[model samples]
Target: MKKLLYIDANVNRATSRTERLAQALLDRLRANEDVEVTTLVLEDEGLAPLNSARLARRTAGTAAGDFSDPVFAYAKQFAAVDEVVIAAPYWDFSFPALLKNYLELLCAQGVTFNYSDEGVPTGLVRATRAWYVTTAGGYCGDYDYGWAQVDALCRLYFGIPDVRRLSAEGLDIVTNDVDEIMADALRAIENEPL
Candidate 1:
C-alpha cells in the first residue's frame, strides 16, 4: 500500500482555512491512487522541542547503533513514507513552533539522512513527493518563508524529488471575498497532479 503522511500544523484545527484546502488536496490525491493516509495533528501530539538532553540521547543512540527508542519513531516513519503533505497557516512569516519541533525530531542524521563517502550529505528517506499547503491572511508574494523552508528541507534533506506548494492568500483582505478565494484554492488543489 502507498503510505501518505499528512502532517497538520494548523493551530485553528477545524476552523482553519489551510486545513480545508489541504483536505481537498488530499482527497484529490487519494482519488488518483489507493493510499493509506496517516494524519499527525501536531497540536494534539504534544511534541516537545529538541533540548540539549534530547539531542545528547539521539547522538548517543546513533553512535551505539541503537534506534529502538520511541524518540526515533517519527524519523523511522518519515523515512518509510511514500509521500508527505504538510498543512499549516502562515503565522509571523512561518508556521507554528509545533511543526518545527516535529521536523527536528524527524531530521535524525542516521535515520533520515547520512553522509556519503565523499563527505556530502545523502538523503535516506523513501518519499518521492511532498506538498506544503498554507493559507495567508495577506499577500505572501515573495515573503513566503514557511513554504520556502519546507521546500528546501524536502529537497535537500528528505530526498523528495517532487515538492509542490498550495496556498490561499489575501483571505483577510477587507475587499476580497473569502469564499471565492477558498474556492479558487480548492480548484487548484483538485487540478494539481497526483
Candidate 2:
C-alpha cells in the first residue's frame, strides 16, 4: 500500500469546513487506491520553530549523518511518504503559523533535501505529489500566497512536481450560499482525477 501522509492544521477540526472538504478528498483518493494514511494533527503535535540551540543540534545531526534525534521525526516521515495532503485554512492571505512551523521542521538537510555537487538543492522526499487544501472567506484570486509558497517549496526544495491546490473560497461572501458552494466543492473533489 502507498504511504500517504495527511497533515491536518485546521484550528477547529470538529466544526471546520476546511476539514470536511479535506476529508471528502481523502475519501475519494482512498476509494481509488490502496493507501495507508498517517495523519499528523498539527494542533496535537507540540511543534516549535527552530531556535539557536535547536539549530545547533540540527546542524550537528545533519553534518554527522545521524538523525536519531526525535527532532528529525517530521523530516524523516515527510521524506518517506509516497503522497501528501496538507489541510489549512486561509488566514490573512496565507496559512496558519502552525503549518509554517511544521514545514520548518520538514526542511531538514540530508533528510527531506540535500545539496548537489553544484551547490544546488536536490530533494530527498519520496512523495510524488502533494495536495494543498484551504478554505477562504473571500475570493483567493490573485493573492493565493499559501498555495504559491507550498507549490514552490515542493518543487524547488522537495522535488515534488505534482503539487495540486484544492480550495473552497468565498464562503463568507454574503451573496453566496455557503452550503451550495461547499457541495460544489465536494463535486469538484469527486470529479478531480488523482
Candidate number with greatest TM-score: 2
Q: Backbone collision count in every prediction?
A: 0, 0
Report how far off residue 70 is in candidate 1 (Å).
1.9
Least accurate 10 contiguous residues by lDDT in model 1: 113-122
Error of 2 at 114 (Å): 0.8
Model 2 local distance difference test score: 0.92
lDDT of 2 by residue, 1-194 (tens): 99999999999899899999999989998999999999999999998899998889899999999999887989999999999999999998999999999999999998999999998999899999999999999998989888889998898899998999988889999999999989989999999987
TM-score, candidate 1, is 0.96
Q: Tell me each candidate's TM-score.
A: 0.96, 0.97
In model 2, pairs of residues that clash are none
- In model 2, which runs have C-alpha deviations exceeding 4 angstroms? none
Clashing pairs in 1: none
> Each candidate's root-mean-square deviation in Å?
1.1, 0.9
